[model samples]
Target: MVNAHQTFVIVGGGLAGAKAAQALRAEGFTGRVILIGDEPAPPYERPALSKKFLLGKEERESLFVHEPAWYARHEVELHLGQSVTELDRAARTLTLSDGTRVHYDKLLLATGAEPHRLDIPGTGLAGVYHLRRLTHAELLRGVLATLGRENGRLLIAGAGWIGLEVAAAAREYGAEVTVVEAAPSPLHQVLGPELGEVFTDLHREHGVLFHFGARLTEITGQDGMVLAALTDDGDEHPAHAVLSAIGAAPRTALAQSAGLAVLPTQRGGGIRTDAALRTSDPGIWACGDVAAAEHPLYGTHLRVEHWANALHSGPAAARSMLGREVVYDRVPYFFSDQYDLGMEYSGHAPPGSYDQVICRGDVARRTFVAFWLKEGRVLAGMNVNVWDVVEDIQRLIRTGRPVDTAALADPGTDLASLAAPAD
Candidate 1:
């Protein structure tokens, strides 16, 4: 029922690539499948790296997306520790770091993203760390354990989810934590000031020091080890180690090198793809963090770096590659856990996009659902310590219908019913 001469190649080794490979086999693609990764380890989930694994509560073996034997058993040609250096779009071939040339009838780029490295001085110090890869997490885990035992100080350079999550884990280890951020509040760009204050208060209650409205100007060290960090405010915080948690940039160099269209950095830069996840080149497809696909729901190109995006988009792209009608329009979603607080945010409401924020529960008690509305319609929703309502929230947003302000803000009202027209 298929062309035996066809071969599909996936160019990333993260969650997206692994899921794409799995979907290819499940979709009855009998042709050869090759999965290439620069990292030596098999694909693994990244959320735990900043949460339980960093806190030593989760085992490294549990992070993998699939057992090592699954690849062999599924006949997925796994190429570990190899980087795809050149993409010859004309010939449909990829040149690897080891000088190996592989041909493919179709290609999927799930290159994922890389953590932004601090350009400040002292980043090369022995105690400085980043948390994008498994190896980095493994090394940081040991450093945190030692710092916890010694009652050492840890200074973080950002207050995004990764920075705050790492700060929480450090507190669990009894390490002194200080976070320096340029924004007035944590997650200012994403959550706006109102909700960002919630995160700031949560971390502060956990004994974490926050130097808001400041940026890390320099990291001072001695004998190749971190000693202190200097902020733009001329204050120096003593630190035994430093973690740069600024954020991540999508890896689009490969796609760009092959003349694929990419979005500008300001637009959440990634390889630009259509609604079907097909890139400028029809023979090539992209998904996960690297693919900035046009979203029919949002009416724009979006590239989300959350685990959910990678989890769903890979299979979507795989099906699209198999010539099935596909539209990659999943609502953006991500969750974070810090100290005693856990939150799941669905939809996008970056600052200036929404007109008002309304809450349905007790914000002081940290059990609430906050909605971002534009012109009285639900644009996004976030539930803090609240569960079983994501579907309702998403439905409300999808309906694009205005609801009664009082009913939208009432916890007693059924969210499902609110999606309908008012009586």
Candidate 2:
């Protein structure tokens, strides 16, 4: 419980949870912080797990959140391998899997999500995999190890970032990879079709097979081994291993059990949260992939499952929990490096969100910067090779200032000159 000193119990020890704990300490919140995580080890980085680690390039220990001394130096009670089975909001306590009750005056729920598994007929068969945690990557790493010199066949179940990243890694490990997505284009709704085309070509160049607008129906096994996954598209193929990367649903069971109201989002997944990252119950907060935040810029509730969003939202929620009012309306940004392309995008430009599309370079040459323009204002910016455009566009979007959209489209115009001087 919280005496004059605040005792905070944070559930889930992924990027969000670790960032929350770090934020509390960074803000001089040195009362008593207990990070309750279900994983056996302390919090570690997750992004590189799919990239460098999966390719067998990164060492395992390099992923640790920080040196062991960092947690000790911050005075945070690091509870590793502990499962918080139930929440006792009435008593302001949590019952661990071991039956010990831990008390807290304030609680931060950063319970990151698990991958959405396919309901296909053979999904439960051996060699079917899910990628969301370090353990999941380790399993795939082991599978790739068993491949020897023979090219492995990998069928990735979704076209999201996780699926595509895993595909890149599989290709690096001498595997033939196929990406299947029900959506018409990869990250289409978020990045819009213009940029999605850029990615379509990129994957094609890498010799990655794409089955767009096709839904998987069954993952059938042969002799207890995962051999083929039939699709709604009437195609059946063999894959040595299948990775279900359909993304994650919000981990809201804890909030729901704690008697807090959980609202479903418009985007077909995740929990709804206010501007301050609080659920219906003020004492509890949610962030990371789980929280659907009301974005002031776009005038919509944006649920971003990106590394930058987690880094931003975690600290934003911690500041709110510490009684500081913070608005998290930054221009959303995410980047992925695949097959010699340093792809990056910031802000969102759904269809009709922008009236005009501005181009700064040639897409035919496979290098350019593009801007989404709405009423002479920069709505979003994407870069395939020229990334400096994002920095200027990010500033222009945050202020909602009028820009010279015509000049910016010419490829020679300097974007920074379009913004109004700061008052």
RMSD of each: 1.4, 2.4
lDDT of 2: 0.80
Model 2 earns a TM-score of: 0.93
lDDT: worst 10-residue window of model 1: 1-10
In the range 1-423, model 1's lDDT, one tens digit per residue, is 335589999999999999999999999998999999999999999999999998888998899999999998988999999999999999999999999999999999999999999899888888889899999989988888888899999999999989999999999988999999999999988899888888888888989999999988888989888999999889999999999999999999999999999999999999999999999999999999999999999999998999999999999999999999998878899999888888999998899999999999999889999999999988899999999989899988888888788998999999988876456
Alpha-carbon lDDT, every model: 0.93, 0.80
Error of 1 at 401 (Å): 1.0
Question: Which lDDT tens digits does candidate 2 get at residues 1-423?
Answer: 223477888888877888888998888686799998888878887888788888888987888777767877888788878878898887889998888899998888888777788887888788999987888889988886665247778888888888888887787777888888888888777666767777777888888899998988988877998888888979987788899988778787877777776656456445667888887777888888778778888887777777888888888889999999888887888888776777788888877678877777888766888878888778888888876677777887777876766777777777777654666
Among residues 3 or more apart in sequence or in different chains, the pairs in candidate 1 whose N, CA or C atoms overlap within 3 Å are none
Q: Please give the range of 10 consecutive residues that has the lowest summed lDDT in model 2.
A: 262-271
